[model samples]
Target: MEPNDQPAPLLEGRFEGRNDFIQLVRDALGVAAQAGWRELILSDSNFYDWPLGERAVIDSLNAWARGGRQLTLLAKSYDEVVRRHPRFVAWRATWGHIIQCRACPNADALDVPSMIWSSDWVMQRLDPVRSVGVAGTEAGRRVAARELLREWIENKSAPGFASTTLGL
Candidate 1:
């Protein structure tokens, strides 16, 4: 390996197709757990198409669910998630202490980027319909991706997506 090569080669660069998107999400979660990344941020309009319910993702998440590590989910709405990602919903309930979910109801759906971000890697779907986007470890691109996610979460969202609800 070159001196600069990452210990684990990432599925880096532009990717197109739904299969690629799902694979990238899975790969990121697996790598994050193995690398002990400090945090992960997932943002989407509604996560209507993400593969968060898969068993492999749950396994990686289970591995990543240790103390002091944080995971945040930002979305215009999680209704789709609740409906589509039942496995993820169950996992979130078990790891609620380390997971934070935010709702961006007022933000335009089109303005919200569909992406997953971590200190070491990021994948963003520039065109959600086609599942086309880019992912990599390029420092400048990672910085920019982090900035965009932070802006939407801090400025346009609020506490939401409770793990449980009480029917009065």
Candidate 2:
């Protein structure tokens, strides 16, 4: 099924308002668990504005893992600095089950613009592939995503991606 065919799992927004962040995280985790997504890409390069966004994301990831589901978190490597802090160590442990990827080469940060741009590049990449599925293992999906990215670039005239992009 398509990622949208199933509900798009909750991804914490850029801001986390103190206690509200907890609820946001809980909700995101709930959606993820229910969706049974194998990978979850999170972009926190902008979390610099909301100091608590990162923490909330980690907390929500923990809650998602606790539910006994697999999820891959996509973020820049720098965020690991925050994760390595003593304060974040415990939360990290709870998040041990989730996989994280640096979105630099893949999708960059998880903002709307980035996602838009990334999807175009991704759609272009996948356009050439005979088939694709996001429900597969992380490794499998990454490989497929790459293959599609290549196809997307190689064949620019493809019909589905003609739109100039909404502004990712």
Candidate 3:
């Protein structure tokens, strides 16, 4: 069945606390899939707190996967991710063809804003430690968010987090 155009639900908020932020991340993914956002981008330091390993998150990602869709993830290091998020690693391996995973190493030590960016929406943890930030669909927010991360995604980051490691 063709997916309906009806959006999932509004998820915009200025969230505080870890649980609230996690809920926003989860809700945003569901909305992103439902709305059929074409490009999904996530930038984080290490993704220590994201729910990427959860089954529900994977389900939403599956729904969102299709031709012409692209997903990108930027991080400083994936060591913590590898240690903490096995499910997401598996998912990434399977979906590697559709994902672009990159790293900011060395002097590119930008304080990568922890955020989720879709074609029409944005959610960022402005103070990640406090789990406090904003999520919205306004054009200004979307544009500013895009501009803030586009440079790193395009120029500063290097290929990272291999979908499948090879050794012999």
Candidate 4:
């Protein structure tokens, strides 16, 4: 099936604490992979360090990419992420064709929380200061987040992975 470009209304809920956030992201990734989702979009500064630091998460992501899934990451601190998260860096290196990353210079000023979108599902950390976040299959919210991600990618200059020498 082709990816849906239409916006869907967002259904929202909250996750409190690091464990809850990690499980939410893990479950969402599994669902997306099982459903053969074509596109996965993530915007975060340090997601590779906290919740997604596990080896299983990295392996799952690699498997999904190997299955022809496409991933776009709009990261705020790409450099730091690579330095701290070797697993993620290695995964990106191995699946550079399926995964593409862009750096958002205005991420801090935007104060956007980390978000993951797959198919119709979305999980977002609404507050940066707290571990609280909202996750749901609300179509509208997913579309809004996707649009914001698109805007960030378009407006910022691409930090070519080649220049970073991360081999991504």
Candidate 5:
């Protein structure tokens, strides 16, 4: 590994496609609960297949929230699910944090306040001076985070809500 190659501390954005998103959401829930991840930054692509994604996303959020962690959604704007889903909307209104990505169009009308993930949030949170020096060695944090998430999925006590399909 190059001395300068390091994994960045990520607050990732993902699209919903097939089972990958499902797995990711499940893993993210575990990571948030076990590793102290504070926010989940999402992109507009998250809405591509609305219902499945919503089911997975909402379940994950509820699971994490019930376990006492926070969820932050970055949105293009308000949509039916965000506006009508009793659980998510309530969370956003009272418990969850939101960030609007205005560049995504229609994001300004989102009903919640959200921090921009790419430019403002991660940049500010990651210490460039410190990370630059130890970027290569600091990757252990990411590996550990992934392991914690995987552990949660394997634990039957915290099994994520089942998807209708076989999760095949």
Candidate 6:
């Protein structure tokens, strides 16, 4: 078979409302999972709530992690995430090794939006309360987004969550 060089179409949009945003995230995650993504990096303060409320998303994440993919989360405040979404605490307890979390002390400077990125795709949530954001699968966009995430993680001195301290 000949090589296929055409670039994947951009998967971009603005979602309105929590359900829509959740669905958008679900779709994005599903694509990444199906594509056999090796790693996922997420930067969000309130992401715990989304997965806690959406069982399918949680299931998908668990399944993805079980398949040996790494899921890293960089959050502004772990206490806040757990406080708002206690279910996450429980979930993390079960999948702590696979779904690792890090603390970002200077999350404000990295403020484009909350985002989830894999090697092949990127999803960003622009508005926290309104659930408005964009997602794309273009290689350039994914690379740029992934670079931004890497830089943010490196610059902020993000630290991995300690299960002993966090009681996870």
Better of 2 and 6 by lDDT: 6
Which candidate tops TM-score?
A: 1
**Stretches of candidate 5 exceeding 4 Å from the true structure:** 1-17, 45-71, 96-103, 106-168
User: How far does residue 52 in candidate 1 sit from its true spot (Å)?
Assistant: 0.6
Q: Candidate 4 — which residues are off by over 4 angstroms?
A: 1-12, 160-168
Candidate 2: segments with Cα more than 4 A from true spot: 1-27, 33-38, 50-59, 77-89, 103-168
Taking all chains together, the TM-score of candidate 3 against the true structure is 0.92
lDDT of 2 at 90: 52
List clash counts for every candidate, in order. 0, 8, 0, 9, 4, 0
Name every residue pair that clashes in candidate 6. none
Residues 1-168, model 5: lDDT tens digits: 245654233334333333443343344444443444455443231232233235555555554455444333433433544445546555444443332222233223332122212111221112211211111113454454334333322331121111122655
Candidate 6 lDDT score at position 91 = 64
Candidate 1 achieves a global lDDT of 0.89
Off by over 4 Å in 6: 1-11, 109-112, 164-168
Candidate 2 C-alpha RMSD relative to the actual structure? 14.6
Cα lDDT tens digits for candidate 6, 129-158: 677777777788788888777776767646
Candidate 4 pairs with clashing backbones: 8-139, 8-140, 9-138, 9-139, 9-140, 10-138, 10-140, 10-141, 11-138
Clashing pairs in 2: 41-74, 42-74, 113-168, 124-152, 125-148, 125-149, 125-152, 126-148
lDDT of 2 by residue, 12-86 (tens): 223323344334434544455445544443333322322233555455445556544443322333344353443
Native-structure RMSD, model 6: 5.1
Q: Write the per-residue lDDT of candidate 4 for residues 20-130, one digit (tens) a residue.
A: 776777766665655667899877765553545468778667657756678888777676666676777777777887777777565573364488877678888876456
TM-score ranking, best first: 1, 3, 4, 6, 5, 2
Give the Cα error of residue 8 in candidate 1, in Å.
Answer: 3.7
**What local lDDT does model 4 show for residue 105?**
63
* Worst ten in a row by lDDT for model 6: 1-10
In model 2, what lDDT does residue 13 have?
23
The lDDT leader among the candidates is 1
